[model samples]
Target: MSQRVPNILLEQLSDFINKEMGLFFSKERKLDLLRGVSLAAEEFGFSDTEMCINWLLSSPLKKRQIEVLARYLTIGETYFFREARIIQALEREILPAIVEKRRNTSRMIRIWSAGCCSGEEPYSIAILLSRIIPDIESWKIVVLGTDINVDFLDKAQRGIYREWSFRNTPFWLREKYFIKTDDGAYEILPQIKRLVSFSYLNLVQQESPEYLNLQGFDIILCRNVLMYFSQPQVLSVINRFYQSLNDKGWLIVGSSEASHVLFPQFRTVNFPGAIVFQKDLSMEVSRAENVLFDMEIDDLIPATTTNYDFSALLNADNSIEEEAEDEDEFTKAVNFYEQGKYKLAAELFKTLLNDPVFADNPQVYILLAKSYANTGDLKHALHWCNKGVKKYRLEFQLYQLQAEIYQEMGKLDKALDALKNVIYLEPDSFAAYFIMGNLSKQLGKTKEAKKCFENAEKLLRLKERDDVLKEFDGITAGRMIHVIESMKSMESPG
Candidate 1:
């Protein structure tokens, strides 16, 4: 019989996996870690799980070995139109904005699906564009799908899928865009298949990402993938993504994974049931050309001022100008926020709110709230968020931010109400339903909690079985259902 993997061995493997693969396996997940390692052991030419564990611990794993391990550690199950609301937002709001903006100019659109598995996502993007763009033939469209798993990439390249892969897809999608093969698998039509290019990418291990021309993308989708990574690795990957996108480009993550705290560099754009990160290259450019603000100040200062000592007066004016230029409040607050100086950021952002130039800007309100929240000042965070909501009643992100603050404060009822407003504004939001379910359970509202969980399950049923729910940190829909069932069973009396 194959020996059972020991606890000590499992602990060592967990650390090694986190260090080498940037995938974390906490003590609670050691069994999962052990199981994955055991599966990888067979591929590594070892039958005994304990022996494979020791071997993996003793030496640095090769690229191929890590790739094999990744196949087991990461969930690859995905289907067309997996996150229906997110896809709808892209098709209705985002793509139209990009197309109209570029129609008169470059007529080019580039989308990257980072961690794309089995080609479903990028292919869906291509298909969506094909449906929307009237002159798609004239536009230079690049939809790139990249994954670390070679097997996944090979399957993606083949463009064939069984009925299982069509779960939650529209009835007409397959008939309209695919051809039935003799082997009984549906193959993506040539036109759609040719629109997407599949490539191998190890996001964690890539020393240089430029080889893939990983820049100037109009949209990057890295959904449900970062939850597996260590916190530092997540931050590193997110920052790299920030650099890769074009000005005003969008980053669509799993709704549950969306957080202003995590993506402070990007501006939040909320669509119905979705929150996407946008690269504001204009802000970076403004910071870069802050010297231009100096020219404005120079022009404002009188060329000749009435004074007894003209040269001395000019020197004093020069000192004053230098001070004003150095103290650009908005730019300094953004820099402080980026540097993680929440107190200083809050102070600076507060200063901007009083200025006529920034008083009405919703971004200022959001940033101020985030700065306060980061510093553990929930009261101030909620206050600013409420102020933002009052000013921009239609802005759903403000309500979302308010809900987070209430949850952090352990005010479950308030949090539930805040999330209700979020749902009212964005009825199809999976995150709202999932989070509200947890909050309802915490408040001992068993029936309400069940209703919420059932609502969430209905949304999950529309996804592939193995597809991870982003907000729950790598928990698959099937696993989450099991959790809900277990909770119910435990709560039931004999």
Candidate 2:
């Protein structure tokens, strides 16, 4: 019989796995961890779990060794049209918009399914796109499915699935899209299968050649993948996704991850039963507001004033100039922020909080919070975010800011609670879902993390091109998708 793993050794092994793969196996999961280690030991030619643990800790694991361990750790649980609402939204709203936008342009649509297990999601996208476009042959339609698991990618490329894969699928869809095999498996029709291609991609390695080459996608779907990642790893992958997208490109993460904090750069678009993020064309405000305001001030305050009482005239001009400068303070604060003078920017933003002109502007609070955060004043940043939430109860952005502040302070529960408010306001907030997933994982609530990741994936699958994200600091939709897939592998079976 194999020797049992010691408690201390088990904890050490768990920590090693968590650090390497961003997977957390708590004390509750000790038995499962032991089993996985035992299997890994057998596969790696070690005599026992202890040997396996020592080897894993001491040696740099080869790519093939990592892949083997991943196979044991990850579970592939997916189906065609897993989330039907996303597909319906894509067919009805997102796709039409992309088609119209591209009609005069390239007339091409490129979609990527990052962490596509067994090829179901990408194939579904291809099938749906073909159904919508009559002239699909004339258009450049690229659907690529990628995963870290070579086994899953190989299975996806084979284009075969069992009955379990179609549990929720309509009969007509199965009949239309697939043919029954003699061995009780269903083989996807060649026409639909040809539309999608599968490959290996590890989202964690952002600097990899495969990741660098992935760019200019019109739509990218990454679902149920990020719940397993470390926060820094998640952030790195998200940044890559931002870089991968074309301007106005759509990034679909799981619906649960629809929070503005995760994709602060992406614009949020709400459709019936779906929420998606779009990379917006960078809008350049002409600086005309400041210029026009300045011009008006110049016009009002004449260079030479030789009228009635000089002192009275000067007082009147000073009052007018003060009022105008007050209005211009907002612009000045923003410029300070751009110039990296966070403290001054924060003070200016705070000053405007009480101004009647800025009272109703939620952006003021967001900027104030950002300024504080930039200055490492997390406490003040959190305070401003909460104040904004109280004042503008319906604005999800305030809650998102609060979550960020809480996260920065290492108050994970507070961050999770803040994200709950963001989700309450915008159910499709992918960033919130992603953050919640991370928080839940940290708390050892594996199932909850999985569900949150799944929700984010569903929402992300319906996005289109030319859609602007409401806010995405640096993270991209593509990277979030990869995170979701990476997390999916680590989720405990329900």
Candidate 3:
């Protein structure tokens, strides 16, 4: 007979994972991994490995199942033009200069969409460049979109999407670019296809990132892509990005990912709800320029002014005036919130709650609620959730939070009720529908539950983009399929 795994082995495994992945799972967190392990055991017909993982992550370890679960659960459903604000800034500030910098020289502006799931993000940037840069006819542009999932890359190269992918995209551009087929699908045009290139890139794979041969990209967009990684992984990727860029090149990331870059080599360019960073190029210029690099984090705050002298860090040969532009204080708060410092983020947001400009803004409240929720303060989280809903009854995000919070509290009925409101406000929220269906099944609400599962399946199928997210879709379909089959079996008159 095989010897059972020891408690010490499990503890060591959990410790290694915590150090490597930044996901804590002591003896208390065993249950967190239990459901997943249980499911695996039911399939595998043996509980040793799964049991070891479960025991390692149980209550004695810490209730870290959800955090551990994040590594597997979320889908990286990114496309080009993921964030409008950064895209706008790219058009206004970065692209123009990049084009000019390459004007007389190689005259080529190279860009990469690292971890691009399907072709959406790279194509979006390429299309924007084509629209903004006047000499696109003569200028050379290289855009590469890459992903680890070969299936996803294949879908990206094919360039077809169902309606959901274009939910936020402007329709007029759709007509100008994509050709609609008789069966209600859109295909990207050859011209736009020619603008970008595609390949496979598994971020955490042991192999090096694809396209190691290429260098000096004018812009690199790895937005919404970094937070999924362990800190060391992110640090490695960020360093690669720093090396890959030419001097003064820009890095556009997700609105929430600013804290991932605290290195002195990059300086932040803050916008209202977004910020981008550029490579700091002045250390080689003068000894006086080195002073900006040495400024301690403690000196970052100017108690009286509430602003940092950002230009001192930049290299501008021109002697100019010192005038602050139309800068928003809220962006700084958004940056904090994105970095997972929920307590500090909540505190920063609380101070801004009194400002009339944000007094009635539902979004600010929603952000505050998310911050509170992240910190494990369910009561305060729900309080802010209700506050957001009172004024902005139609905001679906708050409803999603309430559903999650209620579900966590084991108030299944209340969670479903909250989700029902979400459906009423926004009929197309696949997330809310999926949760509703899952919760309905969990609560044993048979007939109504079957309807929700069917609805979720329909919505997800409707939104499927060339099966680009087939694996992601498959997992959801698998969960729903079992419930749906159970309902069918229950309904049969035996």
Which structure among the candidates has the greatest TM-score? 1
* Alpha carbon deviation, residue 387, candidate 1 (Å): 24
Candidate ranking (TM-score, best to worst):
1, 2, 3
**Between prediction 1 and prediction 3, which has the larger lDDT?**
1
Compared with the true structure, what per-residue lDDT tens digits does model 3 show for residues 1-494?
12244667556655544443333343534444344444434434554664545554444322243223333422446543455546556765688777777778887888988878767888888777877776787877899886654556677889887776675455555776788988898888888788888875555443343546547987888865654454345555666787788888878765434532233467777542346878767644244235443432212111111111122111121112232455565765665665445687788788788998877777788778777766668799889888888888888777877876776567889989998998998897655665666566566676775687577667766653334322121223333332233334334333
Candidate 2 Cα outliers beyond 4 Å, as residue runs: 1-3, 281-494
Residue 86, candidate 3: Cα error in Å is 0.5
How many backbone overlaps does candidate 2 show? 45
What TM-scores do the predictions have? 0.62, 0.58, 0.49
Clashes of 3: 18
Question: Which candidate do you rate higher for lDDT, 2 or 3?
Answer: 2
Residue ranges of candidate 1 with Cα displaced over 4 Å: 208-212, 284-413, 416-475, 478-494
Task: Judge candidate 1 against the unseen true structure and give its global Cα lDDT, from 0 to 1.
Answer: 0.72
C-alpha positional error of residue 253 in candidate 3 after TM-score superposition, expressed in Å: 1.2
- As for TM-score, the candidate ahead, 1 or 2, is 1
| Residues 133-167 of candidate 1: C-alpha lDDT, one tens digit per residue | 87788999999998877789899999999997777
Ranked candidates (lDDT, high to low): 1, 2, 3
